[model samples]
Target: MSGTVTLGMVPVVLTALFFVLADGQITNDFLIAHLLAMGVPVIGPAAIWYWDARVFPTFVDQSADLAANPTAVQRVGDKYKAIFSTRSWYFVVPWIALIVGLTVLNLGFFETVGITGAGDPAFWVYLLFAAWWGLITGIGLHGAVTAVRAIRAVGELDLQIDPLHPDGLGGLSMIGHLAIWTTMLISLGSLALPLAFLLGTEGGYRAVVYLAVGVYIVVIAVSFVYPTVYVNRRAGEIQERELEKRREKIRQLQTQAANLEEADGDTGTIDEVATRLEIQRLRDEFNEYDSVSLYPLSVGIIIRLVSSLFLPIFFTLIDIYLGQLL
Candidate 1:
């Protein structure tokens, strides 16, 4: 995290000089307009790469704990490593970035993108960042789809659910941790967007910023949901299946206790008392399984996601209100 999250800000400092000097458009609030905008791209790729490198490995490592068949689970782990490792998508994502950057350029924000603009040395920086940012977004799009499919594929493993696990999640509580951290990191990157809009020159980038964010919201929201959907389904299946078995066990115990009592006098045999105790234990297990949480989301993770998703917009609204008051 320090490697990715801390090192992620390096580009912010590197680009500060360029934005300050760019096109003679130097200003005191460079941090607000340009650094914030620049951070979106910088922090973004760093977070995405961090998720690809770090979180997934920790999740895949849990395969052994997930089941006794670590070797079979490791094959699924291999597929995960392969999905993230492939570079074939590298060639395609850039093309999409170029197309998007060109379209954003055509929106008339950067002097309509021509030779006249190229005469200014700073023009290329803006143009380059445009394509670079798009490249990051494209990679995000690809990562979102593949990550969801990768998570959904976990159901293919011959994994067993431990109904009596401590976490009450049938030994699968760790699966959704992948989504929680990555989405929060990317959402932190989004904290910059509104400042970029508020301080941007002459409201030129407003429409473009709004359009970019609308699309980003969809993609990020999907990223937020990917890790838990299949795991939640699997949890529900285990809860139902295990509860049925407990019911059957209880029925057998009840019948045995009945027979022992009929064979005994007014005072029952110890066997009858033991059978009743066994039936009560099975009933407790049934209630636990029946009341297992449907969604794998813990309150803490849900709160983290909500705050990450809403905090930027909340701050932006406050800033807007303050501006109106002033």
Candidate 2:
């Protein structure tokens, strides 16, 4: 039998068309709400696409050969510094302006338009905070996490560039781990605001709205974080295996040199020297970060586990509340 149509693109398209058709008659308020609702699914795909296509590819697995004396780590930092100071500012400034503008307009709508009544102060308060938290949680977390991932990628590249530099490898690994933990803390903190709002709601429609919002938060968070942790662990394992192979090669070179030193012709001596050099390079690269190391695979696995464990409950709760919202 042919595969079932599990995808919902058709429905989405229909719904989108319906909204477009309703544009002339629907009030601006309802139109904006519908547009936002439609745009929600686009967010995940957009983030993932940008990260994989633009962000991750650019930074992940970045490396440099030792022939370039000073190494690539410093360049990575410089690249990020430029990004934050300029291109990042372009994206961020507009978001700040939009948020501030929307907030002011929303407040004015409530006050001058007299849409929100005095009797339901709680409802207004809930709406304001929810909207504020939603925007902050999305933009702040994305920017912060992107910065960290870029930094980590650069640090990893640094280690690969100069495996012999003691300070180079170890320092980068430490900094990368620090960035991961910091990212996690910030992410968790961002979620707390929405989660708290859900808890404080009077256990009805409003509560459901908060709950749906929270679920969306958890889904996106776990999706990104879990994959990262999995990839990290896998990378670490691969690194370990490569390290062993390099060590064996080094041993072989040492044995060859010992056997040929006394009776060997120049050709043997030259071959042994070449092998020794290659082994030395591998050893230096493999052991670059002696003091600090992280398994990318393990990190990826941990994040995946956390995501899987949390997502179901997160989604279920959100679904339950979302039903109420509708």
Candidate 3:
């Protein structure tokens, strides 16, 4: 993530240096815009990578416990390796295409905005800035994609479901937490800075900014939530199977108690009492299933996800409304 962000910033920094040497003065707005563009893409991925790095040891430890065999351990390592590896062309290609398309669109936008003048060095510089922006943004997006793929890969892991486990999902709860962090990384890294740039700009582009915000909300919501769906489904299935097993046990015990009651009188009373105790134990087991969440997302994660989407818009609105007042 750091390497990708650094590569993206090199062009802008070099361009800014060249312009400073040649023209002696660069427009403050242009500098600010380019810096924001470059910085926006870096923030989300950097934060996520930092988090991954910090928690990685814990992940490895948990993975080792889950992956009892050497093959499973190797697979777990491969999945982690894939998170940072650029070996996946399927992931890299779309980002490259997006960069190309956005570069063209931004060039046209600069031209339309009168920032691109014929044969002007400044215009070319601005175009380069746009391209750099797209490149970094693409890299950030690629990281997000990698994170999602990692989560999906986890779903394929041969995991043991221990019904007695405290987390209720057989210690696979880490997967859900990882999903939340990855979603946050994508949200803040990919969307926040660009939207900040758009909202900060002047003109009749408020409508454009709002439109972008709408798209950001929808995309982030999906990206954040979708990675957890498969895992959530798996958890639900496990919970259901466990519940069914307990229910079956309860039914058998009840049937035995009913038969004992119909058979005799005094001898059946002790048997019925023992059967009732067993039935109560099974019922407690069934009730414990309620403690197990099919969807691993907690209320806090949902709040954080919502906040990630709304906080930017909230501040943008403040800036807009307050700017009008001033």
lDDT scores for all predictions?
A: 0.62, 0.44, 0.59
Model 1: per-residue Cα lDDT over 1-326, one tens digit each: 56656545555544654455455434434334455556666677677777778777776676467655777666776776676568526744766566455534543434422223544544555555555655555565555555666666665565567667776666666665666775665565465565445534333556766676666666567677756877777767766777889888888889989899888564578889988998998898788667666565777778877877785677467546645554
Give the top-scoring candidate (lDDT): 1
* Residue-by-residue lDDT tens digits, candidate 3, 102-186: 4444443444434444465656564555555555555545655665666666556655455566665666666666666656665
Count of backbone collisions in candidate 2: 13
Better of 2 and 3 by lDDT: 3
TM-score of every model? 0.76, 0.40, 0.69
| Of candidates 2 and 1, the better by TM-score | 1
Residue-level lDDT for 105 in candidate 2: 36
Clash pairs, model 3 backbone: 44-189
Supply candidate 3's per-residue lDDT for 33: 42
- Report backbone clashes per prediction: 0, 13, 1
User: Among these predicted structures, which one has the highest TM-score?
Assistant: 1
